[model samples]
Target: MKIHIIGGGNLGSAIAVGLAKNAKGNNITVTRRNIGFIQHLTEYGIVVSQSNTEGISEADLIILAVKPHQVDAVMAEILPHITNKIIASVLSGITLEYLNKKVDGTNTVLRLMPNIAAQFGASATCISARTADLPKANVVTELFNKIGTAVIIDEKLMDAGTVLGACGTAFALRYIRASMQAGIEIGFDAKTALAIAAQTALGATEMLLNQQVHPEQLIDKVTTPQGCTIAGLNEMEHQGFSSSLIKGIKVSLQNIKSE
Candidate 1:
């Protein structure tokens, strides 16, 4: 597949690198516009840092990674050039309707919510199609699966996916910090604390998935009756861990419909 990616920022760069490293038989072409725009990529083979780049046209897939405010300008510049290709975007807050309106084509446009973990092929991705038939969606889904886990969800649920999976990375990091702090209190080194916290989080997620058990059930299994672990867990619950997490998700969801 001939792929062209626009924009070269953090999320974009990560995805680009992820693709670059895995593009065994795939054609990957990234546009950087001009020398002043992405010179860094010149040294790194179409790197996303600042330099001139080829225009859009040779792509079976067009991935847009521009900022929300700048999406219109980019789309307008490339809209007329689009054909029956797939337009995959990671730009937040912009609806699929707005994108299709700006970039006219019989092409299938998809909105994806992916975390930075895409760089490591572990992202929890959510995709929503605009005018794509199952064949195209499946093809696109398979392509992304090379870099992460992909799920085709309802458009209405995409925002919640963004909240819990996309923006939720920051919240997960915060939880890791809290875990590390508690580890420090128990006399562990900072490095060891972080590693243990990270591993524990991974294990917890795996258990939830493999065991197919509710979170409360898992929690009950972990906390023995009248034990120290139970005491600590109870105190944390009393201080509002679950409530706070729910509130954070609600706030993140509100950000989606915000102007």
Candidate 2:
């Protein structure tokens, strides 16, 4: 796959590096108005350019990772160069319908919601495309799975996926930060507190993934009769922990919809 990624910002550059490191045999080019920022990608054999259309004409997959407001301008610059290429967008709030409209319905447009963790090959990417484009979508999914997990979902849910899969990274980190703070108050050093909190969160996630069981089942295992775990959990619940996170997610979805 010859991949050309436009807008070499954080998310775009992360995807470029992730793909370059994990998916071999694919030529990748990343573009930014100021290549100085992402020039380091060359070490991974990725071509870094300042022009969005530099390799777009030859790209099999053109990834749009620009800001939502910049999509039109970027699309205008490269639209003439695109043929039947697969255009995958990682921009939040940009829908497939809008992408199809931009490309004049000439290309296979896919909306992908992936977080910054893509750079470390740990992103949970959600992909959506037209039903008729499932085969191409699956191919893209396979490519992304090399960097992290990728799941195909209905386009209608793409915004929700953005909230959970993309913005959720921040939410998870905030939880870890809170845990670290608690750990510090409990007598651990800052570094040690962070390590414990981060590792504990990772372990919890791994268990859920490996066991494929309900989170409450694992909670039951940890929350023995009148245990500290249950006590803390109850306190957090009483303070609206889950409710706040749920409301935050809903607000994020609403913000995207409003845009």
Output the number of the TM-score-best candidate.
Answer: 2
Q: Model 2, residue 112: what's the lDDT?
A: 89
Off by over 4 Å in 1: 33-55
Error of 2 at 156 (Å): 1.3
Q: Encode model 2's per-residue lDDT on 1-259: one tens digit a residue.
A: 8999998999999998899888889999999888899979999999999888876878899889888899999888888877899999988877788888888877889988888888988889999999998999999999999998999999889889989999899999999999999999999999999999999999999999999999999999998898898898999999999999999999999998987
**What are the candidates' C-alpha RMSDs?**
2.8, 1.3
Worst 10 residues of 1 by lDDT: 44-53
Q: What is the lDDT for 27 in model 2? A: 98
Candidate 1: tens digits of C-alpha lDDT, residues 67-152: 88988777767767767878888888778888777656566788888888876776778888854456677887887788877888
Sequence-dependent TM-score of model 2: 0.95
lDDT of 1: 0.76
